[model samples]
Target: MTGANGVPEGFVPLPTSAFVEHLGGLYHAPEAPEHTFGMRVGPEHANVRGRAHGGFLATAVDVATSRGARAAMGDGSGVSTVTMTMDYLAPVDVGEWIQLVTTVDRVGGRTVFATCRVTAGDRLVARGSVVLARIRPRA
Candidate 1:
């Protein structure tokens, strides 16, 4: 199945083991029109207070937004996050799966704007916007 934008539906951007193995660094983008992704927060990702680290939350949003933009551009395009702004609304506990939902707000010749939300279960943990620049393939 394809999303309204025509990308394959239910496609995971990363494999399950990829998230499990990475511990502190893992992300998955499940296929959707909203361009959703998620990461499992492990003990290593927690802060001194034992909650998910703010940096990890930001990283998850950045990665999810970048991948979502790339998916919107289709195969063979490379994109990187040029800027990201995140708001922490709530704390994310360790051992919980944080879902990142991204939407391609705009796509221009060389730039893509995206918005993402991070949630643990039904609670909003963080939200952000990412500006990505498309880079030409290396020669």
Candidate 2:
């Protein structure tokens, strides 16, 4: 079930998030399944200038960071991104395969912090960090 870039079929490891699906973002799951995710830039994900939009990039950042936090904390309850900061290093053109490498920085009582480095092959796309709050377990 490998795709053009060798990503397995239905690679998106996380739950079917509305926004992530809207962006056509998917990840490499059942393989690494942690701390890393990827997406192929599509027309819908592009801005008027035919490049990746800031919102799309930011959403990818949030998604990857959240997944990383979940992997590190091993809490299936869920992770809510509280805050995020992104710095666009370069523009990603359409049809490029982008990968986000995320790391969980720390886990507090309820907050988890993580960072991600985005790249398209060898090109830097953006760098970002996010803080996520662990969802409480339901009774």
Count the clashes in each prediction.
Answer: 0, 0
| Candidate 1 whole-model C-alpha lDDT, 0 to 1 | 0.76
- The lDDT per prediction is 0.76, 0.81
- Residue runs of model 1 more than 4 Å from their true location after superposition: 1-21, 24-31, 136-139
lDDT of 2 at 90: 95
Best by TM-score: 2
TM-score of 2: 0.84
Measured with C-alpha atoms, the lDDT of residue 115 in candidate 1 is: 95
Candidate 2 lDDT by residue in tens digits, 16-71: 58877767746755465546788888888899999999999898888888877777
